[model samples]
Target: MKIYDAPFIRAADRYTIEQGISSADLMERAARACSDQILKEHPDIQQVLVICGTGNNGGDGLCIARHFLELSMPVKVLIHGHRESGTEDFSHHLRRFESAGGICESYSGRLPDIPQDTIVIDALFGTGINRPVEGTAATLIEQLNESGKTILSVDMPSGLPANGIPEGTVIHAHHTYSFQWPKPAFFLPENAGYTGSWSILDIGLRADFPGHEHAWGEWVDSSFVLPFLKPRKTFSHKGNYGHVMLLAGSKDMPGAANLCSFACIRAGAGRVTLADDGREETRDEIMHLHRNKLVPALESGQYNVFAAGPGLGRTPSAHTLLKQCLESFRHPVLLDADALNLLADDPSLTMLLPAGSVLTPHPGEFRRLAGDTSGSLEMLTLQQQLSARWQVTIVLKRAYTCITTPDGKIYINGSGNPGMATAGSGDVLTGIIAAWMAQGLSPTDAAIAGTYLHGLAGDLAMKEQGGLNIIAGDIIDHYNSAIKILRA
Candidate 1:
């Protein structure tokens, strides 16, 4: 799914309204969806206190009030603005709700002493809010936040901008029901606290908007990635799948190479040549090379792709070898772990980064490649900045793996779980991406698909193993099953 900014969302709404659809009707539909979700998720709620503003968002709140009242459920409405101060549609809904015997009180800068378990519906402000909320509105939000009630925000949390970092006080919603598409703010870690679990509530707006070509970003789910998958031919042999050269591991950390090579074959790579120092426990299906022979072997090898630097220790020799590969590799390549660390050490190495190369760096690794940043927004900005500058795809690994392309488009992975935080996970991701690249995927597509599939595998593994018990190997073990789902 494509993520839209505040302007595009407003334009979509305007486009729908211009297509002979009444604004009041659209608001009613949006509110009805919100009410349905609330009733479904919190079936045993004691009461609902709808806090409404004076705009279309408030109209949505008023419609929700009427909906709950019609169901004979306990509901109360509070208006932050006078009847004459609200939007034309808001006034329409307010009168209709009142005609249905619903009562509403004006905001008096103090929260009413309601029941303890009342669910507060925050419609004080929505996506149009562009400044810090102040005066009575700010006080109301602050009080509701501290009231120990579950606050559900409409469209967006009050005071949180649809894009960019929020500057001032914002409503801390326990859940946010967005209309049409998700806001860019919902994906950032800085705003995660305010947008506590969020879901897009499709309002079924008219699809007549012009220039649907531009996208803010993508939400990488199975459906979005399914089209990129290539099916295997019945007569295809091992050579058709492509050979992957895995360059990982140091004298001390052989497990990294083992994990990367294991994942490479598991991800459907036809041939995986594991080049590392330790070679005591080698599988018959896997090829091995001593670390000392890597340079000559890379020069002569006809590998389709090279997955480098999982456990390649940050030694001078490792750095020199990485620089050589970056400059010499004709096929696509990926750098991770220590390779990223080496890039941070030598800024000049960035100039040698091959075009269409992939870099999988965790937050700590990304900070080394980029600079130290405060939060996800800064990190994202820097990630895009570096990606465009280097002309390479940067995969910043985290709970939500963010893939920034050289053209500056960002894709956020919607899969994966906390179980992926264990050791050797990044190595597995590096291998998976390289395996996809070897199979003839573009650098950006491979990064996006690999990140999503890796996360999906982890999510599936977490279901059986639980988050606490899941290991990196579990992710590798489930790669085929995850691929089957994506293919289907």
Candidate 2:
């Protein structure tokens, strides 16, 4: 799904109106979607408290209250601002709700008595908010938060800005129901507290709306990636898939190399070669070359892409080997773990990186390479800038791993779970990306596809292994299943 800016949402609404769909009709569609989801998810609740403001979002809340009343559900509706100072659609909905016998109290700057344990429906503000929330509304939000009640926000949290970090007190919703698309705030980690799990409800927004094609950021989903998958030929053989070289593992962390090599094979690499210090156990399928023989191995044209840095213990020779790969290897290269640390120690080592290489760095590694990031938004900006500056694709690993291309485009992955956060996970990712690169994917496509597929494998594994018990190897084990799903 394409992630668009706040203005595009407004433009979409306007375009919908221009296409002869009444604004009131659109409002009803949005309200019904939210109401249906709420009813389905919280059927056992005895009462609901709908907190609204004097805007279109409040209008949505009013419509929801009417629907609940129709369903014979007990609900309390409260409008926090002037009842007369809202959009025409809001006024119309307010009158319709009142006519339907939905009692609503109007509050200017003070909140009315809220019933205990009632699910709170927050509609105080939406994506149009540009400043911090303060005064009576902020006080109301604080009280609502302290109420220990499940809060569901309409469109967005009441106080979150569409683009910037939340400025002040915000409604901490258990779930945010966005109409048509998610705001940029929903994806930033700093705002995760305010914008809990968000889901987009399609309200018949036109996909071919003017200017829709200009969106730069995208949410990587199955539809977005299925086109990138290259089907194998019936006559294909092992050599047809291309070879991958992985430089990983050390005396103490040999398992990292093992996990990476195993993942490469599972990710469909034709052949995988590991160049290490010969301290780790090797799989029969992966050819091992001693660290001293890596130069000759490269000269043999046996590898199409090179990946380094997982579990490579810090040493002078490790740095030298990484430097050699960066300077000598012309094919796509992947750098992770200690390779990132080496570059952090000597920033100039980044200069030796071939254009279109890939770097997989978690937050800590990213901080070492790009300085401190105060929040996810700051981290994202740094990711975009550095990827563009270095002419390399950087996969900044997190809950929603973001892949930034050399041209500065960002793709936020929508897969994986907390269980996949265990040891050697990033190494598995490094291998998956290298395998894709070896199979003729560009560094950018490899990073995008590899990150998505890796996370997806983890998600599939988490279904049976559960998040807490899931390890990196579980993700590797589910690679075939993930590919099966993707191929489906």
Provide the clash count, candidate 2.
1
> Which stretches of model 2 miss by more than 4 angstroms?
108-113
Instruction: Please give the distance, in angstroms, between residue 18's alpha carbon in candidate 2 and its true position after superposition.
Output: 1.4
TM-score of each: 0.96, 0.96
lDDT of 2 by residue, 1-488 (tens): 88888888888889988998899988999999999988888778788889999898899999999999998888989888788788898899999999999998876556666667688999988888888999888998998888788999999999998776987999999999988876777778788899888888888988678999877588998787787788899999999887988899999889899999999988889999899777678788998888898877776777788899999977988888888777767776799999999999889998888889899999999999999878888889989999989899999898888889887788889888778878999999999988888788888888888899998899899887653658888889998888889988
Q: Candidate 1 on 1-488: residue-level lDDT in tens?
A: 88888888888889998987899999999999999999999999889999999998899999999999999989999889776988999999999999999999998989889898899999988899899888888888889899999999999998999987788889999999999888889878778889999998989875457744566888899998898787788999988777887778877888888888888887877889887765535457778877677667667767878888888888998888788776766556788999889989998988877788899998888988887988888889999998898899999888678889999898989999877888999898888888888787898998998899999998889887764758899999998889887787
- The RMSD (Cα, Å) of candidate 2 is 1.6
| Most accurate candidate by lDDT | 2
Q: Relative to the unseen true structure, what is the C-alpha lDDT of residue 207 in candidate 2, on a scale of 0 to 100? A: 68
Give every collision pair in model 1: none
Alpha-carbon runs more than 4 Å astray in model 1:
278-282, 467-469
lDDT of each: 0.86, 0.87
